[model samples]
Target: MRELTTAETVREKGSWLFTVRDQYGELDEVILVPCDNESGSASGQASTDGGVEAWINRCTHEAQRFDTGRGVPMREGRIICPKHGSMFDSCSGYCDNGEAADTTLPSVDISVRNDGRIVLTDDELTFVGEGGIDDNESDGDDGPASTSHIGF
Candidate 1:
């Protein structure tokens, strides 16, 4: 497991976007959003008041980058996609409206240490600096890696 950032940093911002290397050494972006219950209480007893939840930064509908521009909007326990106004339950990544109904955002497994260090728990080390793609899935072609982020 690799430490992504300290708990205090997440607490202050409420959410954060970062990139980590997958098991295959490919760069994958993730977003860490703090979860709060209906009572406005955090999930864990950590000093940060809530456990930081991680998810892939892509929107399930059009596969747009949720972390782009102003970033995903959080309301109550849901994340609102800025493009289509789709609302997704932050915890489950479930969307019930817009073009993304009945879908869910990809989730990234993560854990927060007792001392407040958020770390990736998927056996992949979270890269702390810079970003690069070393994906085996990518062909030698230097064309666009994806078309999901188009029309945005």
Candidate 2:
């Protein structure tokens, strides 16, 4: 597990942007939004009171970075994608409007330690960057083909 930031830090800002290297050795950014404190849940979920939730900083529709420039706008416990005015459920990362309708934001698993530190879980550590592999290209072997999938 990778230590992201202190829990207190996230509680103060309500949200934080974390940049980390994926298993592929490429840079990937995740946005951590704090859930309501009254709920006592550390996992990503929207709350009015303020736990931490993590999601890929990119929009699922057009692959646009949600954290670019001024960052995404938060209203009524949701993050609005500036590119297309899509509102994603902050905790679940579900989008129900705009071009991103029915699609959900990729979530990053995380845990808050007793020491008040936020850590990224192992299963959510791998991410493949855009065009990392070509779908039309092959290994050039006609025999039994091998397949492998990488994702966070």
Candidate 3:
């Protein structure tokens, strides 16, 4: 497994650390965005100092899977949903798409292990952030980017 360049700390409602791990199996990745707050609450929590949050990459129109490429989580801030051009909150997966549904990206149950390693289960990996469409069975042309965002 390789950690993509998309891994970085960001400031949203709280201090969040985002990392996209390339599992390279049935699912191409496990995007982990964890909030570092005193309360560690996902809602109504703000990182007054400076932090970040992360959301899934599912499409807004049909809930199709969106690609984050090698530059995932947008270090500069904001991930444009590749499918519908909707800009989702990279930290929270909330979309301003303005519809009756008011849908947001999916999130995982994140926590720190005893050894200080962020342990995320398979079920948690599947539902990270906003976009919730599975592309595990996508075609060859639909695979994730093979580039690196770190050394760039």
Candidate 4:
């Protein structure tokens, strides 16, 4: 990973980092967060600015990546999975309610450089409220199995 500096943070207000397989290549996208906290018209609302928040997904439950040209974020404040129709809040990247059609999304850690640059790293990411379940993991009945996974 490349070390980020203070000056570089100012240059990239909304910066992103992702791997391109084999650790051979990486891509970054930068956008300016206007006072409204929105980069373009497509995003419905502008959120507050202070810390770094972002969406890391390719599509919604409907399978639509963001329109790079308009800079519209994917599924707005949440990253929804198209395959299972799961929605994960962008801020925490956890499912609001793990219903059949509402699975939680994975969250990547991120940080803000003192100079105002957003830094995304493993340390910055953690599951919201409760971490998402890992494929190799299973939940035991500690609370109330009757209430858990039951939809009203």
Candidate 5:
């Protein structure tokens, strides 16, 4: 199993993004969204086990990405689709409403370790790195690069 990130980091950020390659050699990404605790509260408890769930980052209806390299919009244990209004349960990934009604998001297997380290346990997917693939990565420069914010 390849370690993705710490559970604490996912808990803090509400989600963590990582790149992966499947058995067919297709590159994709996974989003680890934080799940609610037993009391229905999404916060206030810190542990090394079982507070995050991994989804394929695509909606079941239109294949629209839930995260889109940004944070997922969540509401009370449900992951909201940005394109439509479908909501999937954070724990089960079942969508009970909207265009994705009665469908479930395909989940990627993940394990939260005793040491607070989150690892990808799915044999079909290999961990590449953190964050989604940058679409702008190429060998050629389009033009003279301008000094932008964040020191590019």
Candidate 6:
């Protein structure tokens, strides 16, 4: 288990982002959002554990990013997909009323430590670093030769 950040830090924002390398060794981004409070029905009502939950950053409908390197837009314990406005419950990750209805966000395992820090506990993922995967890094090859010949 690798400590990602304190639960309090996630609760303070509408959403949190982190990076991890999956079993395939490809970097992926995950998101953390505030779950419902004690009764577990209302969102962002912080408790001792901070009501934190984790999920893959992509929305199921269009694979749109939930965090996109910034905080996600949320309401009442739900994560709203900015593309089509599908709302997913932060706790259950289920979208019941939109293009994503009947689909659930892919879950990422996580746990809080005694010290109040949240950690990535998924067996198939290794902690990479903070924030989303940096697309700037690339292979030595110049990718595809630019077709437009309006060269520099």
lDDT of each: 0.67, 0.67, 0.42, 0.37, 0.79, 0.80
Instruction: Give the per-residue lDDT of model 2 (tens digit) for 50-71.
Output: 2667888888988877766344
Each model's TM-score?
Answer: 0.69, 0.67, 0.44, 0.36, 0.80, 0.81
Off by over 4 Å in 2: 37-50, 69-71, 123-152
* Model with the higher lDDT, candidate 1 or 4: 1
Query: How do the candidates rank by lDDT, highest first?
Result: 6, 5, 2, 1, 3, 4
- Which has the greatest TM-score? 6
Ten consecutive residues with minimal summed lDDT in candidate 1? 128-137
Tens digits of per-residue lDDT for model 1, 45-76: 33242356777877788876666634457787
Q: Which regions of candidate 1 are displaced past 4 Å?
A: 38-49, 124-152
Model 4 lDDT per residue over 1-152, tens place: 23322324422433332321113233223222212234422223343333345444344344343324334333555444444555555544456543424443333344455555544454433222111122113375456537567667
How many angstroms is residue 30 displaced in model 2 relative to the true structure, after the best TM-score fit?
A: 0.8
Off by over 4 Å in 5: 37-48, 135-152
Candidate 4 Cα deviation (angstroms), residue 26: 9.0
Q: Which number leads on lDDT? A: 6
TM-score of 4: 0.36
* Candidate 3 per-residue C-alpha lDDT over 1-152 given as tens digits, one digit per residue, 9 for 90 to 100: 22222223222211232333334423333344434444433445563222334344455567544444333433234545555566655545666664313666666444443333333443424423222224333355754566566653
Query: What are the runs in model 3 whose C-alpha is more than 4 Å off?
Result: 1-29, 33-41, 47-54, 73-76, 98-101, 112-117, 121-152
Better of 3 and 6 by lDDT: 6
